[model samples]
Target: MTPPPPPCLACLLTLLLLAAAAAPPAGAICVPRNPGGHSKPGAPAKPAPPKPKPLTPAAPAPPKLTPMAPGADIVRSLCLKTDYPDLCMSAIAKQPQPQLPVGKRLDGAGVLRLAMGAVRTKAAEAKAAAGALANDPRTQPLARGPLHDCVESFDDIAYSLDQAAKSLAAGDRDTTGTMLDTVRTDVDTCDQGFEEREELTPVMAKHDAELAKLSSNCLAIATAAGLR
Candidate 1:
């Protein structure tokens, strides 16, 4: 048995034990009771990562050119030649053949008017042929040959007619008659040349019939006006 401890020492030891039990142990921090703590109530969760978007492919470009078929070219050529006949017929049909006073001689002005009308008609026909050549696929490639030839011939006829008008305007009867004859010959030659082309045979025939009627009407007018 040991001697009993002092009363003051015993009291101090009891106070030290109570303080140790109330506080946290060494090397540990005291945590407060709050919503952010481990044992707290409702809290927000972390968000998920976003998905990547898909890529789209670009579209291809269109072709630059397309080659024409053989049959298509042939058809286009025929169609182009046909246009010449149609135009020529239209010009002939629309010609104005006015009857003059009986036994009245056509003055320079009167003759010039008549020749100008004829030349205008020929120009219209030639212009139509040129347009047909430009527009028709079949005839576009061959335009330099038969189609161009037709246009050139009509141009020559128009020129001759224009000269006739000029001569008549100048009061030169002899020169006007000569120029008229030349124009008629040129038109006949053009008609013959068009007929020679196998591709233009039908068209030429149709033109010939219409041209014949026009020529006859023109001759009658010239006779009435005392131009012949």
Candidate 2:
């Protein structure tokens, strides 16, 4: 048995025990009391909102392409051989392309025929114009004679073009060329007939020039194709 502590020491020991009971534990957090007299724990910090993924743009559509005509290259190659490539191209362009079976296309001879056809049509028109001028009473006497000659010359041109086409079909390239030359001569004769009288008929002259170019194109195309 030990002697009792002094009063001062006992009072000090009681005060230390009371202080320990009132104090918080080692790792405890202190929160301020709310107006309702309750101390609630703080909510966990809200997770940062997920960042929106960057938007991706869509790709643009491809451009539309124009389709090329069949045998266009072949026609262009042939036209390059002519003195009047534009005229040749224009004439051939107007012609309707035959719907050949697949794998087949226009040959040089077929293109030559198209040129010949253009010449034939032009010749017929010139003849009709000359006939019209001859029937017009307002026409001068000298012009009438030349116009009549022109009409005859165009008739011959028509016949020659026909023969040329036939000869081409027969594989007679030399005859075809000869017939083409004859058509050129007939056109020249019409021009000379008017020139002899120092006269000019605008209609006949225009026709003559167009026919000359068409005939020349035919010859060039034939030569290019090894037909002449």
Candidate 3:
């Protein structure tokens, strides 16, 4: 028979047996109750990534406008007096700088002269355009006769304009106005031929319209300045 164990040894063996019985099996896994909090002791957890800020909208831009030249007040005021202010503005503004009196200033009489010069150049250009259209092979058969009429009318207009210039130089405002009226009438006559024939003379019509506006401006300037 074997001898019995001592009391202390027996107690230690009892504790070891209890611990083995409470442990997990060989193939079993040990899981934590709170996996999120499972980190190294005393080590701070990484802060969650910062949220992105919302975007803001932008405002609309202002409208763009044409820039006016410095010291153009006289030109602007003169143009305002005309029936076709916009046309007057462009015509006078396009002249050579030297043609304008010192400091780009002009009295009523000077403005009248400037307006007349613009009309004279425009009339010549219109006459040439009419002649070109009349001779063009592509001109419509019905439009040809009207185009020729426009050319002849432009010739009459040129003569009238020359007379008007002479009268203006001689300080004959009444005669100048009369000649300008004739010029305007000749332009209308040319346009009338096309209208009566029901023919489209787009090129000639454009020239006629421009010439009419120039002449009208000249007449208005002449009337206003004649009072002085």
Candidate 4:
């Protein structure tokens, strides 16, 4: 037409038309990807955030001391007036002595009854201790003789304590005093018997010491309560 185009110019025009036809439409967008990668889409969405854990409350503190009932201190204060005040406080302070209402506080006899209950428990324990030592293989050979004496001595204490309880109930303080006095001596008698033996084990001394302490505590409680 317009003086026929040159051969080189015609060839270049043909290449431009082919490239335009192969290109994507206007408004079409493509995401760039890593070379040799397998991702299928536009930008990968961020992973969902982790859920939060539930909160827990701390536990409350425990109380340091327990409240006492009225007249609870009476037992301890009465114990302080005895010869074995230290012993009484150590043995009885932590133990609860039932408190009476204001007009009906425990009198001397009532306190003595409480002391007797404690004494009987110790007596039974002493009896069982000696019996156990006498039978135990580790202690039998070396401690048998002394343990036998201890058993008998503690048995007498138990009997006397029981009799004293009856005497106190009968309003016979004199008899109760005599019985309690014997109970105090019984512990010493056991010790003396052990010392007289050909062999003395530390076990003998140890148990006798405990028996003496228990008896002394009972005696002190009785005296403080004016049992005599």
Error of 3 at 218 (Å): 1.3
Clashing residue pairs in candidate 1 (N, C-alpha, C atoms within 3 angstroms): 76-138, 77-138, 77-139
User: For model 2, what is the error of residue 227's alpha carbon versus the real structure, in angstroms, after optimal superposition?
Assistant: 0.5
lDDT of 2 by residue, 50-131 (tens): 9999999988889887876887787889999999999998988887776778898889888898888888888889999999
Q: Arrange candidates by TM-score, highest first: which order?
A: 2, 3, 4, 1
Model 4, CA-based lDDT: 0.73
Query: What is the total number of backbone clashes in candidate 1?
Result: 3
Q: Whose lDDT is greatest here?
A: 2
Q: Which pairs of residues collide in candidate 2?
A: none
lDDT of candidate 4 at residue 76, scale 0 to 100: 66
Question: lDDT scores for all predictions?
Answer: 0.53, 0.87, 0.77, 0.73
CA error at residue 95 for candidate 4, angstroms: 6.1
lDDT of 1 by residue, 1-228 (tens): 899779999999999999989997779966556643554444454466888778777787887878753233322332233324343334433456445577654342453354346555745565475557646776535333555555665677678667767776676766766766665565566466556655553333444444444443343334444454
RMSD of 4: 8.5
Candidate 3 residue lDDT tens string, 187-208: 8998898788644745667777
Which portions of model 4 miss their true places by more than 4 Å?
A: 1-67, 93-103, 140-142
Top-TM-score structure, candidate number: 2
Candidates ranked by lDDT: 2, 3, 4, 1
Name the regions of candidate 1 deviating beyond 4 angstroms. 1-112, 115-119, 140-144, 204-208
Alpha-carbon RMSD of each model: 18.5, 9.2, 7.6, 8.5
